[model samples]
Target: MFHKVVVTLLVVSAAVIYADVYEPVYKPEPLPYYFNYNVYDDYKGANYGQQEKSDGKAVYGSYTVDLPDGRKQRVDYTADHYKGYVAKVSYYGKAQHPKYYGPAVTFFNQYGNGYH
Candidate 1:
């Protein structure tokens, strides 16, 4: 029985090695032949032979202008090419009021900088 088991193991190992080294691989078909299924042949422009485009108007533009006071003014505009475009200006920067003490800072200076 031990001799039979040893013989079986040796046969399996030799068969695995021979199959791995002697297997035959089939070559892949050409690219053009693979697309000859006749399914996409009836599709319109399926082969990408035609170019299509529509005449559409895209009127959208914006520009930012830096003010002399270290602020930026972003102007956005839009219109049709046949008509006209309109733009509005916007300002962004420091506030018109003081930063720290606000309006009370002026009164404090006038009263000798006293908290009372």
Candidate 2:
């Protein structure tokens, strides 16, 4: 009887340790995932927002800003040298048109504003 009890305790302890050792596959973050646009803020083209066209900017992620100017700004966010720094795939082709772009997960910022 004592041997059986000892074996049971050992098994239970092993399970507890194994549970603690397990690691998650993916890490979660806050919602409305965002980026600091200041890192990569430069435009050489018309700087316009066209949903049909691809906004293929070399960024970790994408964001579209409506500058005081008539033109709508599009941005992409990319992870930096650091691991957490996610690079923008493309901007919200039209920042205002969130619909054109999917949620942060499905969304990627292309050089232009083309959805893939």
Q: Which one wins on TM-score?
A: 1
Candidate 1 positional error at 45, Å:
54
lDDT of 2 by residue, 1-116 (tens): 99999999999999999999999999764343323323323573333332222223222445555553334555444443345455333322332333374555444476555453
Write candidate 1's Cα lDDT for 1-116 as tens digits. Answer: 99999999999999999988985688654232111112233344221121222224534555555444456666666555566777766778863543566454333556477663
TM-score of each: 0.30, 0.25
Backbone clashes in model 2: 42
Per-residue error (Å), model 1, residue 95? 7.6
lDDT of each: 0.54, 0.49
RMSD to the hidden true structure, all candidates: 25.0, 16.5
